[model samples]
Target: MQSELILKKDVDLHHSQDPYRVQNADEIDEDQSIERQLRFVLNRLTPENFQKLVINLINLPLNTQERLNTAVNIIYQNALNEELYSHLYAQACKLMSQIKVPFEHVSSKFISFLSILLKKCEKEFDTDYHKDKYYEYLVKEAEFVTDEQKRKQLLDQANEQLEKAKQNYIGNVSFLAELYNMDLLDDAILHEGIKRLFEKQEKDEENLECLCKLLTRVGPKFDNYKNKEKIDDYFEHLRDIYEKRFSISARIRFMILNLIELRENNWTPRHESGPKRIEEIRNQVLAEREERELRFAQTVPQTQIEFMVADGRRYSLFYGYAHHILDQLKYREDFDRVLGYILKVDPDRHSELFEALICISMDKSDQQRDLIGEFFYQNLKSKVFKLDQFKMGLRKVLLKALESYMKGYKFPKKLSQILANLIRLDFLDISFLKDAFEPVKRDQLCARIMAKTLKLAAEQIGCQNVSDIFELSGLDFNYFFENFENEVDRRDFFKEMRIEWVSTIHEHQRQSVELIQSFKEKLEVIFRETGEEPLAVLDRIEPEFHKEETKTKEFIRALSVVFFEKVLHHKRIDSDKFKKMENILVNFVKEHLDLQLEMLYSVQVLAFHMKYETNFLPVSFMLLYSDEIVERKAFFKWMNNPRGKGHGIAQVFLSSFFEHISRPQTEK
Candidate 1:
């Protein structure tokens, strides 16, 4: 009977004038329209009766299965009719949410029917009031799906449907918290989707990326989220890795930056107790050995396993007993051996550990007063072994240790000498010294260090003095300004050394003149031909120079005055001479006259002016302007009415008044 019915339905479908008419058996839109109508019929069913129907549909034969799927799609389409869509949409949502739909065919058809209802609701109600109910159905659909591909497909479809329906969702922190608990979405997708989902709620879920982004966005508001426990939890994992290495290196630099930057992190256990808290951090890290360590066992990359194992063992041993081990060793031999192992294995992080230890010792000098400086000095020396690139870090550590030592004792002569030499060696990095020594009468110390460093650097390189040091160091003239201040002392020092002091360097004056000449030569060659009338020919066949020698000399002299004297500040050229040169360049015509003139004159002048202000001249041209001239000129007039000034207005005015005006009548 089912086969007979299916044959008739197939014939009827083929004859039907619908867009979903099947060309082949599998090509029908069974889910979109047909199943919708069937679901409507199913919804008219009583709950117990509908459950029985779904159960019977599970055991149906292949032909019967196709017929039932067709009927469900038909019901789905029927629900979209004005009379039936809402009723069926509500019914389908209720049925799908209640008991798990056992059969994939029935479940798939029901989900399609529900989706149609959602669209219909959106169309009719013109709001997403129905979206929460719709999303609830999708989540239910994800749980009941049996086939993996179908499960994934259904989950993906559900998520997309939820996204479209998101505006209708109840945006609240509670909603996101519930969604996370459900775990229906992948971590990355959930991260973004939940952010959108809860954006209207004005509450962001505090995850790693979200926290970092939040910290960046609400920069000053970070104090609100700066919970000590939260920060402890964050570093709690890496505390073992951090402290075991025993050096304040770049590894934890950003973490420390964050800790120092955020006001609430200022009260962290690591900040409070220093090395002792680091021991607690190590203990916390070791606690992860069984639970967290085995998580990577299956997925550990084959090439990294051996390396990771060795590192893990060393890290574990150092972290597990660093406090007890470091304490038992009263002598240098034991400390050096342990420090050597850490430095050799992973040098980057050992520095942070060392810094933490130093902070601890600096804070607790009363307990073990005499040993702190020696321990710090020995560790500082060990950390730098075989690492030439970290000389700067070494310098900082040495300076820090010196400051710590100064807090407790009288200045020992031998130690002071060693400290002085280290400071002098790194005098060029004066910024570090400034940071380390700014708290005391270190300016005198700074001057002594500077004088000593410059003298030593000069001698080491076979030079005579500080000036020779700069010259032989291949530093540019700016180096003097960079190192020395514009103070009376620096001025006196320069004078004592018999060195020249100028406001700027006319570094490119010759090049500026030569560049103008190159452009002039190019233009002259283009117009070198003869037999053109000067006054009669607007379109000239020869060069525009009236009697070549007179024009060339006038052009060169005027250009040289502007290029060399006025611009380069060799000596001030007469203002009338500069104006004449500017007018000459502005009036000259070639294929691209404006561009060529700009290239030859204005750009060269601009380059010269940039050189003069930046390197050579103490006073700028703008600074030298007269208020009377500015008040009289059209330049200020146009500046006051920029929009009213027509396009190319400045150029037109320059051409009309400046370029075309005849000079004063003198002795012709």
Candidate 2:
């Protein structure tokens, strides 16, 4: 689906004016207003169920470090769109402050994101440099460049760097210089670099290519330096040995350029015939080179190969070692003809084809992403492309496409097939699952790939690989356990998913159903007696729980476990029924369980824990039990009244006295 079309439907998603109410969505009952707020965001933002990742983030309480890290990454992804950016950012800002965790402990990426927004608000565009941030951003940008030509293009961006560097960047010039010097052959501007290279005595000999390139850049400048013969001798010696790495045309061009340089400087050579001889050589080389390029551009030669010789006589063949031959072209028609011929003739070399496409695409001034991607689809689709050895194409291609699409970029051709291939090769991991799932909804190939991957992942060994399966499932355990409007709906979905997951992950071994059936019958009567009211009616029971209900069976057991089970441990005596009842309410608060009863339960826990938790009892329970005399009466009076204290019925329960309390924490 196109983004505009999906967004058009987003326009019609009528939301209630009252954001606070939760009307049972898909049979789920959530009390908080944020559930509606979240649903509203997800419906419009997510195009399909696969892309409903905002669902998982919003569904969980964002109180853990791991969840917060995921939130920050999602913030980075959503920042590509202005509308989604504003919404995700606003929610994160609110949650970050609400969580009240330490700022330093959180992911620095999130802190930096918020800092960018804050700076925008304050109208401070210049960010303060700290923690190698500027250099990191530079390296990130550098990852986009591929070969020597691209690096040269980056290096010559000295003008842009000079502008950005005025505001206190470290090693700004050196950074640009590094990219400029990477794999340099022809010396377009190497006079200063050559000077720098010779300044160091213990030079790395392998880097002597820079010296040869320096001669090419500054050879013309030697006339101005007043030691023409000495410099000429030095460069001519270096050229004979090292300049074969450069093209014959590039060498000849330098010679022609040196002649042009002499004329520009109006050099009166000490030998009268020297100037005339140099001019003749320049014209001859230019005419011959032009004729040769015109032929090569019109028709490519077969059985031609580049070679590097080492160990006195041995040679290694160089295929696609140089596209510099074509890059030097002055006419687009000529370049296009040769490029087309090379793709047709040299289809076997994938890297060279990619290089050719990238180089051509980079040279274009308009719509490069679309143009390059379209050309690939039309021309290279027959070549059976696979990801590169290191899998760098996943980042360089698919992710770049995704980022561009989110920013509302339209491609010249739909890239879904290539995108699907990358995903099938495991390029997109779980972290990228949410971000990739949305816009890729349009790409049927990718959608099919995702569905197949998740299906296989469901039955993987040890269930460790099944994390992706569960995450893709998007089924919340707590939602199934407690937050349903219809009891049958909740029970059915919970039972079905639980059984399916357990059996699959455990290799077709279902849990013992007969034992749970026997257990459920014993447990149901007790559960039915304890109604869903504030205080459990403690007139009924004893120390009645069958066992500890510890880790193993707690998760995989039958749904009957939570029915009558409250968190409190109980005893039988009638005198202690109130104690068991009070203990029941307190335990709910401590466990933070069962939303329907949590609010009423918390008031009792806080009130009781405040009075007896320190040493002993409140004044209502006993004057002998009172730990403090000066304010016990006032505390009870303040806790009971509606106008100033609290609600009527709940406060009455909170202020109730218990003759006995549970064991101490240290004893436990």
In model 1, how large is the Cα lDDT of residue 318? 28
Ten residues in sequence with the least summed lDDT for candidate 1: 623-632
lDDT of 1 by residue, 262-353 (tens): 53544343444213434345444545653354455446775553322332442222232233334433333356555554455466655444
RMSD of each: 28.7, 30.0
Per-model TM-score versus the true fold: 0.22, 0.22
lDDT of 1: 0.36
- For residues 15-106, write the lDDT of model 2, one tens digit per residue: 88877765466556432444445445544542122123443444455444444444444443343233322423444443343232224463
Tell me how far the alpha carbon of residue 22 in candidate 1 is from the true structure, in angstroms, after superposition.
Answer: 37
Q: How far is candidate 2 from the true structure (C-alpha RMSD, Å)?
A: 30.0
